[model samples]
Target: MIYFDNGSTSFPKAPGVGEAMANLLATSAFNINRGGYAGAYRVADMVLDTRELVCQLLDWDDPKNVAFSGNITQSLNMLLKGYLKKGDHVVVSSLEHNAVMRPLNQLAELGVSFDAARAEVDGRLPIERVEALIRPETKMVVLTHASNVCGTVLPIEEAAALCRARGLHFVIDAAQTAGVLPLSMKKLGASAIAFTGHKGLLGPQGIGGMLISDDFAKELEPLISGGTGSVSDTEFMPAFLPDRFESGTMNLPGVAGLNAALQYVLKTGTAAIYEAEMALSGRFLAGARALPGVRIVGVDGLEGRVSTVSLDFTPAGLDNAAVAFRLDSEHGVMTRCGMHCAPRAHKTLGTFPQGTVRFAFGHTNTAEEVDICLAALTGMIKGS
Candidate 1:
């Protein structure tokens, strides 16, 4: 089957991901940083190595600043819930996923307010527009590196600079762009970056985290207070970097899988993977745009986007769900329909309420698969 929903979660994960998980589960089930036994030390060491690998991939400075969680959503919640307090204000992009919007919404109920800068009809969020929405009480600016629905890459560097100049925390949701796009902490100047290992990192699910700057880490409170296996004498949480945010027994097996996946990504190189996926997506876009009823959303080219492409079947008087169903059932071409958990993104692309069919390419996908998908789409549109 041809999998085109990598934006949701990567399929056919890196060859070693499952192997590593199995190996860890079989060899050792010990928790990290919880004991003095040799098994515990070994697992803790591996976790630290994984943090260093993450730092390398994101060009972050200190590995200790990276905090692991079950998923990007968890990481985002930790940051949002910990950093923002009552009476604070925030600025967000119109294309942000519910991961960002939901947490902010919860905060709003507690008296926090947020403004959303509208994206261009084409899905670009201008830096000046974001600045215009900033208020004296605006404490942070949250941006998604790329829109999960349309794959429109935002100018994160400019936005980060604006936030830095205004002394507002710049938080980046790198859920869609982490493994596909090259990110540098030094270059973007972001205060925090939340990422998912399963999506673009080519890792298994249940492993993701956030990388925070020294300043952000210091001021941020812990989302959960429990045994970090450190400072046991006191009831309060540890004041250290990672242990401060990490509580209870960590996901050692998932971290092992992520370690294996990171090794694969580093060896293969993000630039090559991105180029290949974009090529496939570009071919798909070219064919889909030519079809009478298929309307491509957002940018049709690879200039400022990832490999995700959204299609509207309304022009052909076909149901979006039916189109996706045919692609999976009749053609063995898997695609995602509906809002993709990003309602705001759908609204920005003018496909809200009736979401579009999304085709997101992965590193393992090929031009041949793109051709097969185009042919399947051709037959579906013609038959309709």
Candidate 2:
């Protein structure tokens, strides 16, 4: 089967990811920080190493600032809910996923409001549009590095510069771009960045985290408070970096998988991965552009985008769901269809109600698979 759904989660996770998790479960499986035994100390040390690995991947300096959570959505919620006050305002791009919008909506009910900097029909957000939305009450600006539905890369560095000049906090939702793109927390000048392991990181599900700056970490409150296995004498939570946010038993198995995956990513390098996936994407885009009734969404070419590509089949009088079903059932070509949990992005791209079929290529995918998909799409259009 040809898996083209990497935007949702990676398939054939990085080498040794499964083995790493299984080894922990089969052998040690001891909880960290609570136990005083040798095995527990060994496991805790691995966890600390994983945090350092995350910092290395993101070009962050302090390992203490890295905090793990259930997923990027949870990390985003913790950052947004814990930082914003009732009278504060925020600025966000129109291409954000539900991970950002849902939490902001919840905050809206509590009088914390936000303004969306509109993106062009092609899914690119202008830097000036973001600048125009900032007000005296705007305390933060959150942006997705790329669109989940259309894969258009946003002007995050420009936006970050604007935020820095204006003295506002900057945050990045790197759900689509984290492991795929070369990102540096220090270079981007972002206050924090939320990332998931299951996508480009090629790790197991249920583990994700954030790399936060010292000042921003201080301003944000802990969303959950419990036993941190530190500062046991006091009832209050610890004032340290990770201990302040992490509570209760952590997902040790997930961390094990992520540790192995991060090693693979670092060894292989993100530039190599980007080149491989974009080669497949370019092949698909070149072939699909010639097909009848196929309307390519977002940028027509490969510039300023990731490996993901979205196609609107409405011009052929075909339902997007029906097209995706045929690709999976007949051709064994897996893909994600519809809004992709980012309705605001669809609205911005003018594909709102009908949505589109998303083909998210990965480093594991090959040019031959792209050819098969292109052929499948051609046959579907001809048969129609």
The best candidate by lDDT is 2
TM-score for all models, in order of appearance: 0.98, 0.99
Looking at model 2, residue 175 earns an lDDT score of 88
Query: Given candidate 2, what's the lDDT at residue 25?
Result: 97
Task: Give the clashing pairs for model 2.
Answer: none
Poorest 10 consecutive residues of model 1 by lDDT?
Answer: 375-384
Instruction: List where candidate 2 sits over 4 angstroms from the true fold.
Output: none
Provide the overall lDDT of each model, using Cα atoms, as 2-decimal numbers: 0.90, 0.93
Q: Give lDDT tens digits, candidate 2, residues 274-340.
A: 9999999899999989988888899878889999999999998888999999999999999999999
lDDT of 1 by residue, 313-384 (tens): 987888899999999998899999999888888888888788999999997898899999888888877884
State the TM-score for model 2: 0.99
Alpha-carbon deviation at 20 in model 2, angstroms: 0.2
Local error of candidate 1 at residue 45 (angstroms): 0.8
